[model samples]
Target: MRTWIRGLVLATLLLPAFPACGQGGDGTRPSPSIERPSVPSASRRLTLDEAQAWHGRHPRLLLAADDVAALRARRATQPYDRIAEMLLRRADEHMALAPADVGKAALAGPDPMPHVLQRLAMAGLLTGQRDYSRKAIAMLAALGEQGYPRRDRSVAGAGDLAVGLALAYDWTYEFMTAAEQRTIQRQLAALATEIEASMSPDGGTFGKLAAQEGMAGHHAVALGGGGLGLMALALRGEVNYLQSNAWQTTAEACLRAYYRDAFGSDGAGIEGFELTLRALGAALPCTIAMRRMDGVDLASATALGSVPAWAAYELLPGPSTLPAGESGGGLGSQDAMALMFAACPDNAAHAWLYDVTHGSRGRASFGRAAAGDASFAGPGAGDVMTLLAYPGERADAGPPALPLGKQFPSAGLAYFRSGWGDPAGDAVVAFRCLPRPHLGRWHLDVNQFTFHACGWGWAIDSGPGWEAADGEPTLTPTVGVAAHNLFQMDGREAAAPCGRTLAFVDDKAGWGLVVGDGSHAMGVTTFRRYLAVGKRDGRPRYVVVIDEIDPAPAGQAANGPQNPATAGEPPVHQYRHFLHTGAGNRVDLSGRVATLTTPDGGTGQFAVVSPPEATLKVAEIRTHAMGTHPRIEAQHATAGRFYFVAVLVPRAAGDERPIAVRPEGRPGPAIAFRVTADGVTDRVCVLTTPEARPPNGFGKARHRLQLSRGDLTQSLLFDLEEPGHDAPSAPDSAPGATPTPAP
Candidate 1:
């Protein structure tokens, strides 16, 4: 365990004993004697009834001897750097090592001991190294002498250890001697009991309900909250290296808790993007292991195709949106994980998963022959899993194409795209609207957007809120708010557990709109922002943003920047719109109109079309705090009821004249205007009163909100709040019924 975990454990024990908390009678750490009860390994046995009940479970852990043999045979004939080859190579290398050498090396890592040991045993078996497998069992049994060296038993610490041992025991079952099996069983009993005690209701010196709770006040329960239950399921009726029933009751209860409290029925993850990904890493193995070892599917606990949705949550498009080598972000992608994860039992999301993970290393590594019969010098991550379960060449190719746009309601992630599966000029926007306060690194970017066009992230929001640390982010002190494309009031980033999507709609005309109520996130009385993705003749033409804000209630103090004055000039409220850009970007300014030239010779325009009172300026800004490389910032400030509108259009730099955007006239809470380069015009009319009611008309193209002047005359009743199809914004207009057919 790291020092931090010790510190956290210490914190819980030493912290205040609040009223009726978890752990003990008054929320204090329970006595070790009471917390962990003794369980002897000698008397335990797997009854015939118990064995009969779980009869359907595969006799092998995951891969049987036959599975290993097949892989080895393939290694000899099928030569490649693919999945099968990777596993076979590693297992063969393990065969070459002396048992003592393997044991000595297992203890060398910082503390991936359980992982290392499991690797040792599985690889040894594949290569028929019985002694090597026995060595791993011995070293692991030694760990039981202490209180199981792994800590943080609840989430993953002890859980990881337990899983590793379980895998080792199952995979090396046929090789272990009776004495070795007994020793391993004794170890398993002690470890399993300890893990159960950590989260048990007796509340070790602490309050019964207080062992572990929500970290960020937002989550109901934290990650690995379900790990204990998963461990119990896998360990039941199994000891050290043999199957047995020891903690069946606890396992069943914990599994219930996992579904009830941890992830719930919906397959949404709350602990941010990367951590959720890690949680998936832990979850997939456990679920599959349960199926392979216990005959219990635990299919309900699966994330149900959440991987792709999580990827969509990312603002940038690439192999992975996570910043490479960023400690807090992620380790790396594991293809087998993604493949199996994508191949859920539902098969509803199979095609999509197949498409997304096709090019990934894990996917690419499977079932192929390479240039050489070469093996690895050492074991690799998840090699055993690859050999145990891999898709052959007979799987379906994939679905026809990726969706043009998608909305993951649980993640509050709405994705807008202009034909990503088609041309290279595709555009995408990851618009984040946290339906509730999502406290963590991800929460820092709620109501923020990452825009991509011309094959690159132009407006990027793709890093941790705090790169140097973990947990809740400090927006003002870091590149928190500045890292996203959002509005600034008194210079603080939009607060989390903030904003919710009021409406998300896409038209067949290649236009999409996402409306978010950002009042809570911005710490304001009333705030709503409309995001519009428009296309011209089948290509990404423009992105329009309409922001309406009321900083605070009458008496609340609202602090903001003021326009520079000539000695003694009165202070004026300065509201600003900020944007962070790609690596190579050129900013061209002409009063309120700014043209952004991207590295690939694509140009996008940001013109303030409404609330003409606010002036604008574009600059390539770089600060020691923000970063060394420059980013784009468009500053805006105006008086009266805040109404800001802009058309951000990215297109080929040499294309025809860009669309002209300007306030129509005397724009009200219900009116705005725009004229496209094709001479077609649009009038935006919004009815945003508390008592306002919308006319149910717009079906699919509700997001575009494309209406003519005469259309507005039909009564300001445009209600595009939920799912709809493209009809007409007003029952009388049909100009935008058909999209220009993605240019």
Candidate 2:
């Protein structure tokens, strides 16, 4: 885990508990409610009768004899050779280290004894070295004498120790003496019992409710699925049959719920990046163990099979992810990717992502592979799991199999890019409009967006929240609307029921658009945002954003908190459209244009072309956790209705092209704009209201857009009220215009 996550965990533990509130009709604060999927009958608990008849041979936890033999035979190959040498070197390093103090380990590092023992045991099995096996046994015996994990500490310590000890014991079962084996088995059983007890309703850190609803928190996987499951598998026939069966049954139930509810149908983790990686890492051990010991593939029955693709899409141009929800802004564990690849060997995109992120020893040309000054040489590199899970003689499939844009409807996330494979050249945009807040981890900035272009993240999300070191009651601004690139109404947080994606159109011709309704998120009558990405001559050119906001009727109840002074009078809302840039970048505001300059000399201009009365202000927002960053706010106040049109152009260094942006078309119910740069002129028109249809003959359309560049013109129409209504084909072209149907 990273330092930020550790801090978050500590802060979460210390924070005061808030009242359990329901969804408020006033839209000031709403509780998150996730509709969990029904558990499949096939995932039901196995009876004690069936478990007693089950038997497993030694070394069947993660590796069989054939697997080890094949690994040894293929040790001369590329990744295999590198991985084998890495494991052997790690074993040598462990030979000099002393057993961890379980009490101290629980508070900070957690028990390292299990990891050390696991590495030594695997090295022994691979090399047939008695010294490695002897060291592992000695460490196991030393740990057995101690109180493995102090009961007063966090349950995570117990969970980690269980996983590590179980793996080590199972791998080295044949090497230990009879008495030593008996002692280790007893310790493993005790660890399992402790973990199970921690999930009890009596005094458990994670209560029984968490076990039933796996997505209740991360503890379901860390404690119930991975730790408990692995320990039970290791002690199956060696311990009391009923005790082992009960542990396995509970572990399987938790895992089933976790795999089903924790992730969306598209495999996007609802809890965001950091927690997802942590959960996946914890779940991998038991997933592999079950597959090897019982011939059951839990991942195959759930969305785990699609996780790699979702992960691939979440990755931005650099090391960070989209940072849509709660995140620490780093590419987490590669071991999870290794395990996913082993289970899904034929997914080309997965292979490409794994190779680009972890194939090399140091940083790859595109993404970060290892930590600073860290080599893939020790147990810290996760050499054992990598060696076991990495597919032999596989080739990276690259980006040909991936689409230029994708939309995960279940997660309400859409990503569009200009191109692929080259981080420095591609222009990417991520838009999020989840139905509701996900376990308080997701921000209130629904319809939020992040943009990356010219090798720099210009518009970014504020990851995690501020935590005061002194334990003061500090505000977490990052989780509020001010920290995201979106529109905020009356400076209030979102308390609406949900945000909906009204329409999505991704064309193969290098232009895409996403329309989202965030009225509920902003607690307004109507709030829709239209974001479009355009490419000129097969290269990223510009992005255009159109925002429409309409306040609720005078007599109607607004979504957020209303002024008490006004009482029942019509409310006047102050709408602030926000845009954020990295702290290292410099922002200069001139009239309606905000020019951002990167440290590497890259430049991007955000020009507001509509609502001529809007004012632009640039300032630095300082937070305790994320430091200081530049923020651009387009302030506009209106009681009736309003809309905004902005164009963003990212230019590489030394590209001195004059860009022109201006409002287009006569006054109407829609916002129209044109952006011209580098001899390419792009025009966009967005219909703001569905009831008050525009006079341009766009009949009965709930959402309508017209995009034109050169001689290609595409018109998209969507009727959000009618589900699964196929959009009509485009009308015949007029002169130079070639109308293309909506996708």
Model 1 CA lDDT for position 215? 23
Query: Per-residue lDDT tens digits of candidate 2, residues 553-626?
Result: 32233433567876564557787888877668889776667778888787777877666667788877665434
lDDT of 1 by residue, 160-267 (tens): 556666666666655667677677666777666665565445533111222323222111112232334444444454432232343443433333333232222234
TM-score of each: 0.67, 0.78
Best of the candidates, TM-score: 2
Those runs of model 2 whose alpha carbons end farther than 4 Å from true positions after fitting are: 1-38, 42-56, 73-75, 100-102, 109-117, 137-158, 198-219, 319-328, 360-381, 466-478, 496-498, 537-540, 551-575, 621-628, 664-670, 689-743
Per the 3 Å backbone cut-off, how many clashing residue pairs does candidate 1 have? 35
Clashes of 2: 0
Per-candidate clashes come to 35, 0
By summed lDDT, the worst window of 10 consecutive residues in model 1 runs over 4-13
